[model samples]
Structure formats: C-alpha cells, structure tokens
Target chain A: MTPQLEIVIIAVIVSAACSVLGVFLILRKMAMMTDAISHTILLGIVVAFFITESLTSPLLIIGAALVGLLTVYLTEALRRTRLMAEDSSIGIVFPFLFSIAIILITKYAGNIHLDVDSVLLGELVFVPFDRLIVLGRDIGAKSLYVMGTILFIDLLYVILFYKELKLVTFDAALAAVLGFSPIAIHYSLMGLVSITAVGAFEAVGSILVIAFMIGPPVSAYMITDKLRNMLILSTLIGIINSIIGYRLSVIFDVAIAGSIATVIGITFLIVFITAPKRGMLTIINSRRRRKIEYAMASLLLHLCNHENTDREEIESNRHSIYQHLNWSKKFLEKILYKALNLNYITLNNEYLKLTPKGREYAIRCYDDIGYSI
Target chain B: MQKHVIEVEDMTVAYEEKPVLWDIDINIPKGVLMAIVGPNGAGKSTLIKAMLNLVKPISGKVLFNGLSYECQRRYIGYVPQRGSVDWDFPTSVLDVVLMGTYGKIGWIKRPGKKEKEKSLDAIKKVGMEEFVDRQISQLSGGQQQRVFLARALVQDADIYFMDEPFQGVDAKTERAIINILKELRLRGKTVIVVHHDLQTVKEYFDWVALLNTKLIQYGKVDEVFTDENLRITYGSTDRVLKGEV
Candidate 1:
C-alpha cells in the first residue's frame, strides 16, 4: 500500500477507536476527563520506558493505561474532598501529573526519540514509515495494526458492556441498586480511554487525540436520540473527518493530525447549526414561533375581555390596540396578521372581535396560568 | 404479626461530618405503602438512599428479607428523584423503561422480545403508551415522572423505594403514580416513598415515618402522623403547620 493510503488508514482507525469510546465519555459528561487522561498518560509512558529501558516495549502501553486510570482516580478523590468542584479538581490533578511527565522527559529522556512537541501534536506523516515485519515479510504500517487492534477491542468492549454502560450513564443510583457496580464499569472505560490515547499518541498526539475522542460523539449527540445510533453515527463521522482531513493535508501540505482535528471541529460546528431537531437553527425557529403564538394568545385574551365590555369600542379598535399592549405598530400588525391567518380574531367595522375559537383558546390559556398559580 | 420486608437497623449517614440521617431504624412490613416525610433537608431522601446503599452509611446496616442489599438486590427496585437524571439523554421512553430489566437480563445480552413486552406493559400502565417511541427530552415534568414510575414498575421486585416521584408532576400524573403504588401494595409488594406533601400523607399512605436527622415516630398513619410528631419533625418552622393543617 502507498504511504499516503497507509497514513489515511491509520488516522481513520485512530479516530474510529476514539469516537466509539467518546460516545460514553460524552454521555457521562466526562469529556474533559479525556483531555486530562490523554495528557497525564505521558507520565506512565516515561516511567515504563525507564523500567524497560526500551521505547518499543509493550509495557509502555500498559503503563500509560494505568496512569490514565490513576488520573481519573486522583481527580475523583480530589472532588470527593468537597473542598473543590469537579472541574477544578481535574484542572489541578491533570496539570500536576502531566507537568511531572514533561519535566522527566526534558530532564532525563532528552536523548530518546520522545519529544514534548511531538507527543502533544503528533506527526501522522511518520506513521507509514513504522513498518511491522514478521520473518522478514512486510506486513503493513505498525500504527495500522496498533490502532486496528485498539478499535477492535473498543468495539468489543462497547458491545459486551453496552447494557451496563447505558444503565450506569443514564442512572448510576439505579445501576447500583441493580448490582451493576458502576465504579467498575467507570474504571474499565477510563482504562480503555487511556489505552486508546497511548495507542493513538504516536500518530495523532495527545492534544489532537482529545479532538478525535470528543468531537464526533458530541456531533452525533446532536443528531441522534438513540445510544446505538449515536455510536454508529460518531464512528461514521470520525471516518469522514479522517478522510477529508487527509485529503486537505495533501492539498495544503499542513499537519495531518492538525488537519483532522480541524475537520472534527468544523463537522461539529456544522452539526450544531444544522442538526434537524436539536440544532441551533431549529431552536431559534421554535423560539420565534412560540413568541408569535404567545402574542396571538394574548391578543385573543385582550379582545375576549373587551368584546362586550363598556370600553369595547375603544379597547378593541385595531388601530389603538398596539398602544394598550405597549408594542410597536409593526409587531402588532404581524401578530394581527398571524391571528387572522389562524382565524383567532375577526375585523368587524375596524374593531377586533374574538371568534368563538379565539374565545375558547383565551379561556384555556387563562386556565393554564390560573391552574398553575 | 406482619412479615417485615425491609429492616433498617441503626443506619446513620453523614456527609463530611454533617449528619444527614442519624441512627435511623425502621422495619417496613410487606403489602404496606409507607411514606417517609420531613421538612426540606430533613433526610427523607437520605433515608431511602441509605437503605438502597446509594449513600454509604457512616455506621449501621439495612437488611432486605433477612439478606444484605447486595445479595437481595434483584428483589429491590429504586426510582430516584425525577430531576436526578439528565432528560436530554439520547434514548426513547421504551429504552429507559427497558433498563429496569437489565438486572434480570444480566451482563451483555440485549433486551429481547420478552423485555420489550414487559416495558410496553409498564408504559401502558403509566398512560404513556403513545410516548413509548418518543425521545425522553420531549417529555414534560409529569410525563418524566410517570416514565420513571414506569421504569420502576418493570423491575417487578418485592420492594420498591422512590425518592420524590411527585416532586413536580401534575395532579393527574400524581394520581396515576399513586394508583400504581397502590396496585403494587395490593400485589403484596412493599412501597416506600420519600414524600414532601404533608396533607396527602394521611390519604395516600398506610404507614408514615416522621424523620428529622433522626426517626421521630413511625407507625400506622392514624397513630404516628400526628400534630405533635409533625411539629417535632419539622421543628419551629411553620412549613409543617401550613402544610399539615
């Protein structure tokens, strides 16, 4: 396979793995914790390298996964102290552990292949160069097999624990009562997250790893109301982001990981603004419709109140109604047009009169407000 | 003599040295709908949480049918406060209701046809059959409360604990929930609720436990739900006086 193809394939696998787990992290409101875990796992890699004395040892991955779990444990422990909020706890624990790893790397591991900038912002361009050879027969890019294995494990974990994960995320108390052991599930998830970060770190870097982990899931969250659909949608979005990002990098000669992360951001922005039901456009449209409906309801009530009263001629006159309502003439005219369109009011000799339908609606609105009070 | 389904023995809970429930001991018998009533922050919800082991008790233990919570978990159902969960979660009413069956379904193994049937029946019982496929975010406060009640109903347990199921529900939804609770009692299940409405305690519950950091009085509604016990439970706050009278 071509180097460019291998690179795109690795980026796709990394994103697929990150986005699958990202669904749960997003649902559990622990997306920020991923940011913390992705950074702090560097400490685990450093310590593992010192012990193995070889950067290529598998212990580095295990070590990084452990440190990811440790970061979560420390953050939760700090939050449980009640002295600081959860975000503040994360803010403290993350930097404290991550900075330690940075210091160790710059001071001691300077002679190794590890560098701070490459760790934070990975070089996807080098992914195809790392080849896995078995008995002198070339297999494929090493990162491809690494990320492919990680994605397969992630898919298996999600499928096996989908029920438990869903129950716990939706309701932890109930999950506890039902004997699911939410704590165990939580640590296992963080463990996988750490492992995924470690696997994707060399290709996507830690900072961009967060974008892959959080971006697709949040975008999927805006599009679907079902967990399974969210998972599928996020995985699809991740693959699309990877391909588009790879193509864009080819055209612009920019960083591959950076390009992919930017595509993830752009995709989320598009989903946020255009998702069918929960998008910003839908919310704004609904708000405007509700405002018009409310105004029409108020107009119906006003006409109903004055239709047969002593001041009926003065108060119900269409021209002077806007003054009593403290509304602009243009706004009142829009409301009147809507009311007329809905047949809620009728203009009789320049005076606004409530139709029977309008009167019934006015009474119901009163009951709604009155009953609640 | 009655068969005690739940036995709370010297259960004391505290949060960071501030006692929420202190030395609470109550034996709840089967087939009785009981109410745990108190003023705001009176540990009514804490008492339920402690019993369900949701909140760790600083000291003491609770037993269900002579077994510990962990051993007897399958026989117990819990409905947390309606506001406890995020409503915007991307799941349908049927999906949330099916979660009740997770305990029986056990690790992995998605909810099959049987579980779906049970969930549908529970949703119908709560008058939410039409909303079975509707996303949870579109539900109103009362619909959300009913959906929670339906979720608990599908548990099909011997005993159920609900924390403020009627916190913000409409009167019609309240009636629907109380009917389900009454039906559960008629079927010989023990129903314990953390309730705030003082006026309905006499009407809705057969047994009442008045609590304020400690169990003040607990017995049949006519005997324990008295002005003196309420006054003791609520202290000098006129909230009790205004609500009960």
Candidate 2:
C-alpha cells in the first residue's frame, strides 16, 4: 500500500497502454504525428489551465485531446491543399502552438503554482501521491484512473474499427469505395492518439513517451510479421522495458523515465541484431552459411564425378576441375580432406569411393539446397 | 427496354476552376459490362469519380437506379485505381472484403457472422478463397486487384463502378477478373469497368463507352464499335475517319 509501488504500477500500465496504440501508429508511419501531438498538447493544457484556473482539472485532459484532434484535422487539411508537405505542415503547426503556450506560461502563469518542467519531463515519483478517493475510500492514484480510461478508449476504438482502420491505413481509396470512410477512421485514430498523449503526458514526459509509443512497437515489428502478434509483442516489450528500467534506475540512482527509455532503446537494439529470419545478424550468417554449403555441395559433386579416376589422373585434372568449380585449391583440399575423414569418400591409391553416409548426405544436401532456392 | 442503371446528364467536373471532364452525357442499361476508355488525360478516371459522387462535377446530375447517390448509396459499389492505396497496410484479404458490408451494417455496429459469411462468399467468387487470410501486402499485383473486386462483390450491389481494375494485373488474373465480371452480368448485376486494352475491348466488354474529354460513343459492342467511331474516339483527330476497304 506504499506510494512507490503504486507509482511503478501506474507507470507500467500507462507505458503499456501507449505502446498498444503506438504499434498501429508506427505501422501506419504516423510516429512523428505522435511527437507533434505531444508538443502541441502544451497549448491545450495552457488554454485549459487559463479557463479552469486549476492544474488538476479534468478540463486540461479534455482540452488537450480536442487540440490533438484539431492538430490532425489541420495537418490533413494542409496536406490536401498542396501548400506544404506533411513533415513541414507538422513542423509549422506544433512549434507555433507550443511557442504560444510557452509565452503564455512565462507572461501570466509564471507567478502561479504551475510547473511546465514537470509537464515536459513527467514526475513519476509524485504520481502516486495524487490519490483518487471514491466515497471517502482511497481507490488508487488519480493518474491511474485517467490513464486507465484512456487505455479503455484506445482498446475500444481499436477493437471496434480494427478492420476499417487496417483497410484505410493500407488502402484509403479502397476503403472509401467499400463504404468505409478513411477520413472518419483517420480522425478517430488520431483522436485516440491525442487522448493517450494528453492522458499520459503528465505521468511520462513527452520525450520518454515517444520511447514507449514507438520503441516497443518497432522492436516487435522487427521480430514479427503479423499485426495481431505485433500488438501482443509490443505490450510485452513495453512492460519489460518499464520494469527493467525502473529497477535499473533504483539500482543506479538515475532518472526513472530516462532509464526506461534507455531500456527500450537497448531492447530494440537486441531485437534488431538477433530477431529470427529477418535480423541483421541472422541474414548475414545465413548468407555465409549458404556460401559454405554451396562450395561443399559442388566439391562433393566434383569428387563423385571423378571417383573412377586414378590419383595421378585426379591430381593432373585438379586445375580444370577447380576452374569448373570456381573454388580455390586450398578450400577444395580442406573440404576434400574433411569428406575423407568423415568416410563420405575414400582416397585409395588416387581413386575416390563414395561411402553410404557420404552418398546419403550429398542427396539430402541437394534436396535442401534445391528446395531453398 | 430495360431501365438505365446509370444516367449522367451534361456532367462537367473540374478542380480549382479548371475543367477535367467536360459535358459528359451517358446512359447505361442494366446487366451490361461497360468499359470507359480514353487517353491518359482524357478524364476517364474523373468521369467515374463524378458518377460515384467522389469528385464533385462542376455542373450536372448523376442518377443510379433512378435515384440520387444519397438515396441509393448502398445499391452502388466502387473500386478505385490500384495505385490509390498503400499496399503495405495491415489487413488480410478477408478483412478488406468484410468492409463491403459496412454500408449495410451502418456505423458503430461491428460486422457480424452474416457479414463474414458474405465476405467469404465474395472471396470465393474471385477465386481468392485460399488467400483469404493472407495480408494484402503479401499478395501479388493480380491477387491485390482480385481482393478489391471481392470487396466490391461483398457489397452485393446492383451496379458496380471499377476504375482500372486490371492496370497492373497479369493476363491470367485479368482473365479471372473478367470471368467474375461475366458471372456478375449473368446474375443480372450491371458492372462498369474503366479499361485500357483496346485490343481485348471487344472480348471483355459487352457494352462500351468511348470517351475523349467528352462522350463520343455509348452503346453495345456491335452497335457503336465502328471504324469511324474508333477513329473519332482514339485517332489523332476527331474529324479523321479511317476508311474500311
């Protein structure tokens, strides 16, 4: 019932929720929009603060979510106008809104008890102290309730429009023709992202939020091809990063958010290098293995073909055979001696005989190579 | 004397005050496979868009089944150009076809068992049942086109408007798609396709609408596909007709 455990729990839950939505956004190439929404949300928070005059007001979340939706709408409208490219549109809009928020904060809100630094880099240590009470009973952290609601909304939106969103993200025109409005689905998705951004912004700073949003999903993408699998993997990765990062921070005396981000980055790096089939290391090793197998197979074929020749005949024709195999004599001799040792072939007075094992091995090798090619 | 499934009267579509398709008037009867053919910039796509109300025409009216688009939206199905979407999108073939039932299912209601059955039937119709679970991005160009067709088929509409469905498809897939269109016609549905291959025009389409920035010809393949009209529709000059020896 201590606050530290509660804070870690809330952080983990919020991080997992953001990562779920992040998988879809990253797949749709809207990661930057998440960045834009996180920044522009500051303006919405400021506006809401100006109206409600309370930093803890629900108006801040509502106002920020609405602004997030507005950001998507305006960015889409600007993109359609040919006035500017997509990145440029995002760049122009978020900075303008964020700068205005900063000015308002410095000019009028500085004297107030508002803190922008906490908003930028969230105070996870303080989150558990903001308690939620229902009927004079302490339920949990207030941020947990807010984040849980946002997560529920995200899950609901994704489940309800899962098919429509997939179609629109892949092929908007086809979606439109099939009577699914890509525009509507797009707005709905962006709205969810905005809501998540605003809901989680106070708990996890915007920069670290990006790590939770994109890092897990991207790492999952590196490991899996199916969308459903990607979502599950991303959630697992997010949870792992949150727990490991928190523990590492506790042990090393570092910032929790920074440590969490570092964990995600490191996990992503591991997935990048070691993912099965598609990982960089796997691909490189497979290529090298294939080359070695190719040389070995060709050597077996050459020796099999020249089995009837004498030792002197084989030695004299080695140059022509090497040119035919396109292999160096050293590599050829190394493989040839290994095959002899394995009893796959016998070099008796310069004549080679295929042992039963060698013949069987050669046949299996050919089949494997043929099927793979 | 069957009623016209689609009727366009003096339709002109423009973007930013510049006209793209000018003064198009056409009437297509039910149960005919019609091809809308034109040169690259002749607004063939624009014409189809205008009919579907996807693109607003400068001045004209489009009627489907004797009703406005709003009233008969569910009765009409459209398949846009192949390149108009991101092929790398995260959806299976069956998932795309299930979207066809969304019109009747309405907003906020998820596609249920009936919709899934209808989608499977459509996928079977397009000979893509085996690939129903395959992600759209993993499909070949021709299979992708078939998936689009299956989506339209799942709509189960009386009239279908397809824009360049065979653009990047291989010959075998093109033939498979044509066979499905033929089956649709036999089932008494009117299917209109935006086609390009002039050589296979007669083989693929039962009705043809020749367009060159305007409606040059519209009738059955035997009735309106003349040497004179072909020259006017596709030849260098509208006035120059090739002589039939």
Candidate 3:
C-alpha cells in the first residue's frame, strides 16, 4: 500500500478506537482524565525505553498503560484528600507526572529517537514509514496494526461490559450496590484508555489522541439522546473527522494529526451550534421564546387584573401595562406583536384586551403561581 | 442464625475526624418495612451507609443475616439518592431497572430473558411500565423515584436499602412508592428507607428508627412516633412534627 493510504487508514482506525472510549469518558465526565493519561503515558514510554533499551518493545505499551493507571490512582488519591476539588486534583497530578516525562526525554534520553514534539503534537506523516512485515512480506503500517488491534480490543471490552460500563458511568453508587465494583471497572477502563492512548500517541501524538477521545463524543452527545446512539455516532464522527482531516492535511500541506484535531474541534463546534435539541442555538432560541412567552403572559394577566375593573382602568392601559411590567419598549412591542399574531390579545382603543384564549392561558399561569383572580 | 435482618453493633462514623454518627446500635427484624427518620445532619444517611458498608465507621461493624456485608452482598439492594447521579446519562428506565439483576448475572454474564422479565414485572408493579423505554432524564422527579424503586425490586434481594426515596417527589408518587414498599414487605423482603416526612411515618412504615447523630428511639411506629421523641430527635420545638402522632 502507498504511504498516503497507510497514513489515512491508521488515522481512521485510531480515531474509531479513541472515540469508542471517548463516549464513556465524556459521559463519565472524565475527559480530562484522558488528557492526563495521554500526556503522562510519555513517562511510561520513557521508563520502558530505559529498561528495555528498545522503543519498539511491547513493554513500552505496558509501561505507558501502567503510568496511565498510576495517573488515575494518583488523581483519585489527591481528590480523596478532600483538600482540593476533582478538577483541581486532576490538574495537579497529570502536570507533575508529565513534566517528569518531558525532563527524562530531554535530559536523559536525548540520544534516543523519542522526540517530545512528536509525542505531543504527533508525527502522523512519518506513520506510514513504520511498516509491519510478517514472513518477509510487507503488510501495512505498524501503527495501523496496533491501532486496529486496540480498536478491536476496545470493541470487545465495550460489548462484554456495556451494561456494567453504563451502570458505573451513570450511577457508581448503584453499580456498587449491584455487586459490581465500580472502582475495579473504572481502573480497567483507565487501563483501556491508557493502552489506546499509548497505541495512538506514536502516530497521532498525545494532544490529537485526546482530541479524538473527547471531541467526537462531545459532538455526538449534542446530537443523540440514547447511550447506544451516542456511542455509535461518536465512532462515526471520529472516522469522519479522520477522513476530513487527512484530506485537509494533504490539501494544505499541514500536519495530519493537527489537521484532524482541528477538524474534530470544528465538527464539535458545528454540532454545538446547530444540534437540534441541545445546541447553543437551540438553547438561545428557547430562551428567546420563553422571554416572549413571559411578556405575553404578563400582558394577559395585566389585562385580567383589570378585566373585572373599569374599562378605563390603569392596569389595562397599554402605556400603564408597559410601565408596570418593567419591559423595554422594543421588547414590549415585540411581545404585543407576538401576542396579537397568536390571537392571545387584541387592541381595544389604547387598552390591551385579553382574548378568551389569552384569559385561559393567564389563569393557568396564575394557577402555576398558586393564586387565583 | 440471627433473627434480625441487620445488626449494627456500636457503629460510629466520622468525616474529617468529626463524628457524623455517634455510637449506634440498631437491630432490625426480618421482613419489616422500616424508616430511618432524623433532622438534617442527624446522620440518618450515615447510619444507612454504615450498615451497607458504603461508609466506614470509626468504631463498629454491621452484620447482614449473621454474615458480613462483603460476603452477603447478593442479598442486598440499594436505591441511592436520586440527585446523586447525573440523570442525563442516556439510559432508559428499563436499562436502569435491568441493572438490578447484575448481581445475579455475575461476572462476564449478561442479564438475559429472566432478568428482563423481572425488570418488566417490577416496572409494572410500580405503574411505570408505560415509561420503560423512556430515558431516565425524561421522567419527572416522582417518576424517577419510581424507576429507582423498580430497579431495586428487580434485584430480588432479601433486603433493600433506599435513601430518601420520597424526596422531591410528588404526593402521588410518594403514595406509589409506599405501595411498592408494601408489596416488597408482603413478599417477605425487608425494606429500610431514610425518610423525613414525620406525618407519613405512622401511615407508611411498619417500624421506625428515629436517629439524631445518635439513636433516640426505635420500635413500632405507634410507640416510637410520640411527640416527645420527635422533639428530642428534632432537637427543638417540633414544628415539623406537629400532629405526626
């Protein structure tokens, strides 16, 4: 296979794997833990290199994974101290371990092939060069095989423990009561995250792995309501981000991993703005509608307050209603127009009069406040 | 074998070296629908957690049917506070209820047809079968409480521990919950709840344990639901306990 194909294939495979776990990480509110594990796994790789004297040894993956677990445990330990909050605990632990890894890389292992930039920003362009061969035949990229294997393992882990993962992520206390050790499940998930981060860190880099792990899932979460749909949508979004990012990299001659991260970020942004239910636009639009509704309801009640009073009562006067309601002139006009359009109110001379529908609605609104006119 | 379903031997729990629950000894008989009542910060929740081994007591241990909690975990089910979890977790009511069978399903084993049937039956009993497929977050506060009770029901455990199940729920939902608890008691399962509504204590629970960082009184609700016991447990004039007798 050509190098370009190898790069894209590896990117796609890694994206899928990271995103599968990413769904859980986002739902569990442990997205930062992924960031922590990915960065600190550098220390694991450095340690493994020191012991094994070879970068390609399986011990490297094991070492990085162990460090990932260590990061989780240490963060939990700090959180358990009750000295700091959860986010502070994570913020403190990962940086401490990550700086140690960076020091080891620059100070002790400078002569080694480990480049800190590649570990952080990724070296996807060089991924195609690491060819995996079996029986003297060139198969494909080594990163491709490693990521594909991890993806399968991730798939297996998710399938086997879908219920358990859901239980723990949703309610750790209930999960514990149901005889599932939430701590055990959490650590195992961390182990999986560490392995995935290690596997992809070499190709996409630590930051990009985190992007694939959190970005796609967050984007998917905005779009889907069901857990199953969220997981599936996240995997699909990750794969799409990989493809788009790879294309963008080739077109612009930029870094592939960075392009992918940027693309995934843009994707999340798009979903955040446009998603049907939970998007920023949806929230803003609903708030706008609520404000308008509130004003119109207030107008109806103001009219109702004067409905039994004289026809020329101050509460029913449009100018007085405007003054008493504490609404800006523009907003009041908008509410009046909207109410008139909805046939909730009518203009009787200079007075705001409530239609029957408007009267019913106003009565319900008053009932909501536990009062009656 | 112990006649009591749960026995707490001088349990005392502390947080940050400050005692939350003082030395407390409470022995609960089998198949009783019991309520643990106390004012805020009275360690009502702490006592329940201590018995379930969720909270480590500084000085005492609890026994479930003469066995330690770790050994007899399969016989216990729990409904933690509804507010404890993120409701937007993308799981359905049935999915939550189905988790109740996870203990019996054991490791590496999926909850199969039997578990689903049990979950459905539990949902039906709680009058929430229509909402089985609805996501948990879609349910009202009362409905959420019912869903949790259903999850506990599917556990089929000998004893169920519910923490403030009636909290934030509507009166109708509270009634529904009490009916389900009654059914569980009828089936010879013990139900222990951390409840606060003193007015409903006599009407709902068969037995009551009133706690106040210490045990004030515990027995049949008719005996323990006195005005004085409530005043002492509440630590002042009992405005929250008027006419509870």
Candidate 4:
C-alpha cells in the first residue's frame, strides 16, 4: 500500500478505538482522567526503556498501562482524601509523572530515537516507514497492525462489558449492591485506556490522542441519545475525521496527526452548533417558543381578570392592556400575533377577547401558577 | 414471633474516625414496609449503605437470611438516591430496567427474552410502560424516580434497600412508588427506605426504625413513631420538625 494510504489507515484505526472508549469516558465524566493518564504514560515508557533497554519490549506496554492505572488510582485516592476536588487531584498526579519523564529524557536519553515533540504531537509521516516483516514475507505498516489490534481489543471489551459499563456508569452504588464491583470495571477500563495510549503514541502523539479520544464521542453524544447509537456515530465521525484530515494534509503539506486532530475539533464544533435536538439553535428556538407561550398565557390571564370589567368599551382594549402590562409594543404584537395564529384570541374592533379555547388555557395557567381561578 | 429477614449486629460506621453511626443492632422482619427516618446528616442513608456493604463499617455484620451479603447478593436489590447518577446518560428506560437482570445472568451473559419480559412487567407496574423506549434524560423527575424503582423491581430480590425514592417525586409518583413498595411487602419481600418526611411515617410504613447516629427506635409504627422519639432522633428541632406544626 502507498505510504499515504497506510498513514490514513493507521489514523482511522486509532481514531475509531479512542472514540468508542471516549463515549464511556464522557458519560462517566472521566474524559480528563484519560488525558492525565495518556500524559503520565510517558513516565512508564521511560522507566520501561531503562529496565528493558529495548524499544519493542512488551514490558513498555505493561509499564505504560500500569502508569495509566496508577494515574487514575492516585487521582481517585486524592479525591477520596476529601482534601482536593477531582480536577485538582488529576492536575497534581499526571504532571508530576510527566515532568519526571521529560526531565529524564532531556537530561539522560539525549541520544535516543524518541523525539519529545513527536511524542506530544505525533508524526504520522513516519508511520508508513515502520514496516512489519513476518515469516520472511512483507506485511503492512506496523502502526496500522498495532492500531488495528487495539481497535479489535477495544471493540471486544466494549461489547463484552456493555451491560456492566452502562450499569456502573449510570449508577455505581446500585451496581455495587448488585454484586458488580464498579471499582473493578473502572480499573480494567483504565488499563485498556493505557494500552490504547501506548499503541497510538508513536503515530498520533499524546496531545492528539486526547483530541481523538474526546472530540468525536462528545460530538456524537450531542447527536444521539442511545448508547449503542452514540458508539456507532462516534466511530463514524472518527473515520470521517481521519479521511478528511488525511486529504487536507496532502493538500497543505502539513503534519498528518495534527490535521486529524484539527479536523476532529472542527467536526465537534459543527455538531455542537447543529445537532438536531441538543444544538445551540434548538435550545434557543425552544426557549423563544416557550417565552411566546408564557407571554400569551399572561396576556390571556390579564383579559380573564378583567372579564367582568366595569368599562365594557375599554376593558379588552390592546392599548390599555399592553400599557397596564408594562409590555413593549413589539412584545405585545409578537405574542398577540402568536395567540391569534393559534385561535386563542380575536380582535373585536380595538378590543382583545379570549376565545373559549383561550379561557380554558388561561384557567390551566392559573393552576400552573398555583392560583385558584 | 416474627421472622427477621435482615439482622444487623453491632453495626457501627465511621467516615475517617468521625463516627457516623454507633453500636446499631437491629432486626428487620420479612414482609414489612420499613422506614429509616432521621433528620439531615443523621445517618439514615448511612445505615442502608452500611447494610448493603457499600460503606465499610468500622465494625459490624449484616446478615440476609442467615447469609453474608456477598453470598446472598442475588436476593438483595438496591435503589440508590436519584441524584447518585447523572440522568443525561444515553440510555432508555428499558435499558435501565434490564440492568436489574444482570445479577441473575452473571458476567458475559446478555439479557434475553425472559429478562426483557421481567423488565417490561416492572415498567408496567410502575405505569411507565409508555416511556419504556424514551431516553432517560428526557424524563421528568418523577418519571426518572419511577424508572429507578422499576429497575430495582426487576431484580425480584427478597429484600430491597431504597434511599430517598420520594426525594423529588410528585405526589402521584410518590403514591405510585408507595403502592409498588406495598405490593412488594405483600408478596413477602422486605422493603427498607431512608425517609426524611415524618408526617407520612405512620400512614405509609408498617415498620419504622428511627436513626440518628444510633438506633433511636425500631418497632411497629405505633410503638416508635412518637413525638418524644422523633424529638430525640432529630435532636430538639423547630416546630415543624418537632411534629407540633
């Protein structure tokens, strides 16, 4: 396969896996914890390299995964101390470990192939170069295989533990009472997150990994309200982001990983503004409709209170009622039009009178306001 | 001569050496709708958490039908506080109720037709069958409370622990929940609730256990639901709390 194709393939696989797990992380409000763990895994990588003296050693993955779990464990432990808030606990734990790793790399391992910049902002250009050879036959790009394996593992984990994950995320105390140890499920998820971090670190880098992990799933969360649909939508968004990002990088001659992360961000922004039910526009529209309804109800109530007005000629007059209500002429016109459109009111010459339907609605509004008619 | 379904022996709980509950010994007989009543921070919820082993008791033992909670977990169900979890989670009412069957299916086994039927029946009993497919976040506060009750009901456990099921529910929802609890009790199941309201203690509960960092009283409603005991449990309250208003 072409190097460009290989790079895009690796990016897609990594994005897909991260987005799947990102749904749970977002739902559980642990998305930041994933960021913290991915950062802290650098310390694990440094320690594992010092011990094994080999880049391909499986101990590196184990070490990084362990540190990921440790980051989460320490954050939780700090939170349990009742000393600091959850974010502060994470802020304290990951940076300390990450700083140590960076210090160790700059001071000691200056001669290594591990580029700190590439680690933070991954280099997908190099992904196509790392070819895997098996049984004297040429295989595909090594990063692709690694990311693919992690995606498969992630898919399996999500499917196998869907029920437990949902139950625990939605209600941990009840899950605990029902004999499902939420703590156990949490640690296992952290461990998997750590492994995924290791798999994607070389291709997407630490910072970009978070972009993939959080952005698409959060976007998908706004787009859908079913967990399974959210999962599927997030995966689709990840793939779409990967393809568009790859094509953009080709045109701009820029970093592939950074492009993917940027595309994911843009996608999230689009979803945040345009999601059918949860978008900003939808909320604003609903609020405006409710405001109009509330205003019409108030207008009807005013007319109802003056139903037996002493002055029959001026009682329901719009000018008198609007002035009495302290409402702007535009506001009066807007709600008046809306009520007339709904057949709740009619203009008898210059006076506003409530229809039979309007009186019933007015009575309901009185009860809603905790007042007896 | 009544048979106790739950026995709590020397159950004491402390949060980092700040004693929350002290020397609490109580026996909850089967088929009784019991209310654990207390003022704020009086450890009413703590007692239920301790019994379910969600909280590590400083020193205590809770037995369900002469067995450890872990050994007999299949026979116990719990409905945590409505605020315990975010209702915005991407799940339907049916999915939440289906979780109650997970204990029976154990790990790796999915909820099949039988489990779905049980969950549906639980939803029907809660009068939330119409909302079975609705997303949880779209539900009203009372509907969410009913959904939680249905989740626990699907467990079909011999004993249930509920923490403030009526905390924010409407009057109709509260009545619906009470009816379900009554039904469970009639079917020989034990229902223990952490209740804050004292006015309805006698009307809604047959058994009352007043807790305030200790077991103030545990007996029938007529025996324990008294003005003097309430005053003691709440630690000298305002007129409303003193049950004088």
Error of 2 at A305 (Å): 20
For A98-168, candidate 2 gives per-residue lDDT tens digits of 88888999998998755678767887887888889999999989988888888888877777776666667
Model 3 residue runs over 4 Å out of place are: A368-373, B112-114, B238-245
Best-fitting candidate, scored by lDDT: 1
**Chain B vs. true chain B: TM-score for each candidate?**
0.96, 0.93, 0.94, 0.96
Off by over 4 Å in 2: A133-138, A281-373, B112-114, B226-245
A53-144: candidate 4 lDDT, tens digit per residue: 98877898899999999899899999999999999999999889899999988987889977689789988888888888899887989888
Q: What C-alpha lDDT values do all the predictions have?
A: 0.92, 0.81, 0.89, 0.89
Highest DockQ: give the candidate number. 1
Ranking of predictions according to TM-score? 1, 4, 3, 2
For every model in order, what is the iRMS?
Answer: 2.2, 4.4, 4.4, 4.0
Question: lDDT by residue for model 3 over A190-276, one digit each (tens)?
Answer: 999999999999999989999999999999989988899999999999999999999999999988888999999999999999999
* Residue-level lDDT tens digits of model 1 in A1-373: 9998898889889999999999999999998999999999999999999999998889999999999999999999999898999899999999999999999999999988999998999999998888999899889999999889999999999999999999999999899998899999999999999999999998889877999899999999999999999999999999999999999988999998888899999999999999999999999999999888788888888888887789999999889999998899999999999888888888899988888998999989888874452
Error of 4 at B127 (Å): 1.0
The residue pairs in collision within model 2 are A170-B89, A311-A350
**Position A134, candidate 1: lDDT:** 88
Which sections of candidate 4 miss by over 4 Å?
A311-315, A368-373, B237-245
Query: Each model's DockQ?
Result: 0.71, 0.27, 0.48, 0.61
Which lDDT tens digits does candidate 3 get at residues B7-101?
88888899998889989998999999999998888898878788887777899889998889989999999999999999988878998899888
**Clashing residue pairs for model 1:** A225-B90
Candidate achieving higher lDDT, 1 or 4: 1
RMSD from true fold, candidate 3: 3.0
Q: Per-residue lDDT of B1-245 in model 4, one digit per residue for the tens?
A: 87788999998899987899999999988889999987777898899999999999989899988889898899999999998889889889999999989999988779999999999999999999899999998888899899999999889899999999999788889999999899899898999999878788888999999888989999999988888988788777685555642
